[model samples]
Structures are given as C-alpha cells and as structure tokens.
Target: MDKQKAQIWIARVLVTAVFAINVQCAIQFIAWPESYTYAYQLSGASAEAVVRGYGICFLMWNATYPPVIAAPHRYRVLFIVVIAQQLIGLVGESLLLASLGQAAGLGTLAASITRFIIFDGAGAVLLVIAFALTMRAARSLKEPAE
Candidate 1:
C-alpha cells in the first residue's frame, strides 16, 4: 500500500477505536445505570439518573465520529472537533478529580473519575496523532509529484 493510504488507514483505526470505547461506555451507562452506580459506589435514584444523562451525552458526542470514520479525508473538520472534545473531557475530568482529592468516603468517586481522566487523556493523544497523520496525508496529495 502507498504511504497516503496507510496513513488514512491508521487514522481510521484510531478513530474507530475511540468510537467503539465511547459507544460501549454509553451502552453500559444507559442500559444498566444500576451497574454503573453500584460499581462506582454511588447510591440512590439521583445517581442512576446522572449516569443515564451522561450516557445520553456520550451518544450525542459520538454522533460526530461516524462521518469522519466513513470518509476522514472528506470530513476533516470533524477530526478537529473530536480532538477538541477529547481535550475538553480530559481537562474537565482532571479538575473534578482534583476537587475530589483524597477525602474520606470519596475514594470510589475519585477513582471512577480518574478512570475517565485516563481514558480521555489517552483518547486525546490518539486522536491528535490520527489528525496529524490524516492532515499529512491530505497535504501529500496536494504536493507536486517528483
């Protein structure tokens, strides 16, 4: 395969992996809020509702991925959007984790938030790499051939 095709494929795989992780999490949150709450050491109806709400947000956010996954070269802007979103998630979750601190009884919540921080951080890195690779490939196409 040519360099451009390889680059595009790498970007597609990375984006697909991110989408899969997010969709899996969304399904778990939406279909079984109780499981999430229990595992996260949360309790009560409010916790369940919050989990469901987050799941909805996940679904909405993931809407940006399909087009990019389908034709990343055509939908290049979505790459920027997805990368920015990942960064936002990472920063926001980091702040929440800091606020929770090592306070007593909040360990579970902090740990759960930490997991988000890790995932978002990793996702952001992956998306950035994918975006760079895709952009490089696009640029290569525009450059004069030797």
Candidate 2:
C-alpha cells in the first residue's frame, strides 16, 4: 500500500479506537450508573442521576466522531475539534483531580477522576498523532508528483 493510504488507515484506526473507548464508557455509565457510583464511593439517588447525566453528555460529545471516522480526509477539520475537545477534557479532569487532593473519603472520587485524566491524555495524544498523519497524507496527495 502507498504511504497516503497507510496514513489514512492509521488515522482512522486511532480515531475509531478513541471513539470505541468513549462509547463504551458512555454505555456503561448510562446502563449502570450504580456501578460508577459504587466505584467512586458515591451514594444516593442523586449520585446515580449525576452519573447518568454525565453519560448523556458523553454521548452528545461523541456524536462528532462518526462522520470523521467514516471519512477522515473529508472530515479533516473535525480532527482539530476532536483534539481540542480531548485536551479540554484532560485539563478539566486534571483540575478536578487536583482540587480533590488527599481528601479523606473522597479518595475514590479522586481516583476515578484521575483515571479520566489518564484516558483523556492518552486519547489526546493519539488524536494528535492521527491528525498529523492525516494532514501529511492530504498534503502528499495535493502536491505535484516528482
């Protein structure tokens, strides 16, 4: 396979992986909010409700991924948006984790937020790599052949 095709494939794979991870999380949160509340040491109906709400927001956020994953070259601009969103999630999660530092009884919540930070950070890196590869492939296609 040619370099451009390979790059596009890699980008698609990366984006798909990220999308799958996010969708899985959303499904779990929505379908079993109680699981998350238990993991985070949260209690009561309000905690489960909040978890479900977060799952809904996650679904809304991930709605942007499908078109781009379907056609990375055509939806190249969305890569930027995806990367920006990943960074935003990473930073926000980090801030929240920091704010919860060393608090007794909130350790589970902090750990859960920390996990999100790691996931978002990794996702951002993958997206950035994919975006670079996609851009390089696009550029190669546009350039005059030697």
Candidate 3:
C-alpha cells in the first residue's frame, strides 16, 4: 500500500483508540461517583459538586490528550507532557479531597490506580502503536522532485 494510505489507516486506528478510551472514561465516571467524591473532598468540594465538576474536567483532559500524542513527530514531547499531566492530576485529585474536608483511604488509592491502568496505560500503548505506524508511513513517502 502507498504511504499516504498507510498514514490514513494509522490515523483512523489512533482516532478509534481515542474514542474507545473516551467511552471507557465515561463508563468509569458513571460507575465511580464514590471514587470522585473521595478525591473531591480534598478540594473542599461537596460530593455532588465534585461529580459534576470532574465530569467536565475529565472530558476536557481526554479531549486534549490524544491529538498531541498521535502526531507523527514530537511524540517524545507529547509523552513527557502526558506523564506530567497525569502526575499533576493525581496530586490535584488528592488536594481536592483534602480541601473538601474529607478523609482519604486506601480504597480511593486503589481506585485511582485501577482507573489509570484501565484508561491511561492502555491509551499509552495504543498511542505508541499509532505513533510507530505513523512514523513508518512517513518514512515510506518518496521525496518530491526539487
């Protein structure tokens, strides 16, 4: 197949993987309100408010993360940015819980770890695959006439 076509295929796969991750995130949000509250308390927000607020924040994060990583070039920068964001997010979540005047627990910790594995870890692997495929396609393109 031509390089352009391969690039298109890789883009499609990456987009689909992102959509799948988004759906998984939605399901997690729906299924894990308690977990949200556990983190939200650190922020001094009420459980109800946390549920609503985090829904928006999480969607925004998901919306932005994929395109950067999926780009054929600048992947190392994208990867580092993603890791930093995740680290910041965990810290922020913890703070949110504290500000809410709520206590933290190992259960919340477990939930956070599980959620990351289910969502970000899988997305990271898919992003790597997509990046490799995209780079391979880019390399295959013939040079244009000078």
Candidate 4:
C-alpha cells in the first residue's frame, strides 16, 4: 500500500489496540476484580471498588476512539486529545511507580506498576509514532500538485 494508506492503517490499528485494552480492563475489573487487583497487591475493603471504578472510567474514555479509527483525517483533531489522555495516564503511572518503589523498594515493584510500564509504555510509544506518521501523511496529501 501507499504511504498515506499505511499511515492511516497504523493510526487505526493503534487506536483499536487501545480500545481493546480498555475493554479488557473493564471486563476484568467487573468479572475478576480480586484477580485484577492482585497485580497491584490490593486487598481488603475498597480495593475492588477502586479497580472497578478505574476500569469503568477507562471504558468511558475509550468510547471516543472508534470514530478516529473510521476516519483519521476527520478525527485528526481528536488524535491530539487521545495523545493528551495517554500522556496524562503515563504521568499517573510514573507517579504510581515512584510510590510503589518507595513503598516496596527496588527489590519488588508492584506487578501492576511493572505491567503498566511495559504495556502502557509501548502503547504510548506507538501512539506517538502513529500521530507523527498521520500528521506527515496529512501534510503530504494536502500539498499542492508539484
């Protein structure tokens, strides 16, 4: 496929992967809250409630992604919003890592924090790359005939 099409496909696939992750989070929180919370080493009162709430919030935000997947150009503006949201989550993840590191020390970081860094870091990287490619593709498409 051509460059523009490849760029668009990359954006769509990246967004779809994000949406799927959110869906899995929501489903897991609802169906297996305890198991899900285990990664964070959470237990006792309010752990499940917190996890479920966080998952549901992700679901709400992820609802916005499908439109972008359909038409990256039409939803090009929304891509900024998506990136911002992901970046914000990364910041929160960073804070969590710091907090966990402090609490557990370097020896045993919470599994949840580790998983977030690995998976979410990858997603963040892909989103940045997809955004750059999409922007380049849009710019090239809009240039006047050479």
Residues 13-129 of candidate 3 have per-residue lDDT tens digits of 774666566656655665666656664334434564566556656676656555553553334355445545555655655564455453455556555655654565555566566
**Model 2, global lDDT:** 0.87
Question: Where does candidate 3 stray beyond 4 Å?
Answer: 1-4, 23-45, 65-105, 142-146
* Candidates, ranked, TM-score: 2, 1, 4, 3
- Rate residue 91 of model 3 by lDDT: 63
Candidate 2 lDDT over residue span 1-146, tens digit each: 99998998999999999999999999999999998987677789998998999899999889989877876776777767888889999999898888887778887778788889989999999999988888898888774311
TM-score of each: 0.92, 0.93, 0.53, 0.82
Q: Candidate 2 regions off by >4 Å?
A: 143-146
CA shift of 142, model 3, Å: 6.1
Off by over 4 Å in 1: 143-146
lDDT score of residue 125 within candidate 3 = 60
Q: What is the lDDT of residue 126 in candidate 1?
A: 89
Positional deviation of residue 115's Cα in model 3 after best superposition, in angstroms: 2.8
TM for candidate 3 is 0.53
Q: Rate the local accuracy (lDDT) of all candidates.
A: 0.86, 0.87, 0.56, 0.74
Clashing pairs in 2: none
- What tens-digit string does per-residue lDDT give for candidate 4 at 48-74? 887888778878877777776777656
Best by TM-score: 2
